[model samples]
Target: MPGRMERMRAERRASGEASFFYREVAFNADAVKVMPGEYFVHSEDLVITTTLGSCIAACLWDRQAAVGGINHFMLPGDGASDDGGRYGSCAMELLINALIKRGATRRTLEAKVFGGAALIAGNGALNVGQRNTSFVLDYLRTEEIPLVSQDVLGPYPRKVCFFPKTGRAMVRRLPPAQREAAIALDQDARRRASASAAGSIDLF
Candidate 1:
């Protein structure tokens, strides 16, 4: 039988109150994986993980509350679309809201930003990574959230694993081959975003 915490989580999902915005995968074991355009917050020490190439993932946690969340955004802003976690605006909002719901105060939040690498070989003109990098920084500044650490802007991909309650983190730099894979992922996302109708792009 599921424990009390598991029962509450299941109830939330069944009621559609805890929307992942995308499909919610089964989260068992000791770790949770967040996909692009997704975010998760928790008060446990369970590992929250994501990978990034040109995209950006921001990890925010409150020490006193022992809670944290991570968000992976594909772009900087939602442009014309509504604020959704898939976009940076909505993503940040969702993350912040989740943390608060987990007993964290907005003022006590500290951030660690990652990703925003120049993943592709010759797409400097696009500046997707740069935009993502700056957008999060601007968002944090405006929100008055202290940025405690960041590893942004480069030419390689990264895999980030964060433990919320313990505030422990691990970053692994993917090799060139895997970096290319990351680039491919972003390219596909960008292409799809461009193909979508006007006023439909999200920040993530």
Candidate 2:
């Protein structure tokens, strides 16, 4: 018989939702990192991890089915271009669909939202964190998914670890060094988005 980790990886592979998997030394367990524009779902005893600055990481779980998934999104909505999980609209839908496909029902779904830190120092108009935060909150309300818990809208980046099968989530505010790294990551994402926009000429 296959072990839990093996079964988990097999399921992930079958569903084409595999991310970066590794043995997490700190937790001494099988783990996968869900980066920006990425999400993962599983029904095994595995940990899903992600680091967030301005981006939002939403963990949706169905207790009855014991299935859950997490998504990391940088922007509020999907624009003219289809950028996969980078946009909240696409990310949320992808995660919910995957969970339902894994036997989770929308009626029993609950959410824990994290990140959305205002790490960037500038005008309020440029705060993507606030925008992302608002989008996810409104989405959950509109979908009628119960928001069980949340830690959002602060000045610090966060590292989130989520256990899917048990619906347990742990969050740690990153220290100074890690905070700088997170800010750098967010800045790079912004630059990429700007460049992508600049290269495209939209038709009116």
Q: Considering every candidate listed, which one attains the maximal TM-score?
A: 2
Least well predicted 10-residue stretch by lDDT in candidate 2 = 195-204
lDDT of 1 by residue, 52-97 (tens): 8877889999999999888887777864355355567877887888
| TM-score of candidate 1 to 2 decimals | 0.82
How large an RMSD does model 2 have? 3.7
Q: What is the lDDT for 117 in model 1?
A: 88
**Clash count for each candidate, listed in order shown:** 4, 0
Q: What lDDT tens digits, residue by residue, belong to model 2 across residues 1-204? A: 987666665652522254578887778999999888788998888799999999899999999999999998877877446566777888899899999999999999999999999896763766888888999999999999999999998899999999999999999999988877898898776555444456442111
All models: lDDT? 0.75, 0.84
The global Cα lDDT (0 to 1) of model 2 is 0.84
Instruction: Please list all clashing residue pairs in model 2, or write none if there are none.
Output: none
Instruction: Give the TM-score of each candidate.
Output: 0.82, 0.88
Cα lDDT for residue 120, candidate 2: 63
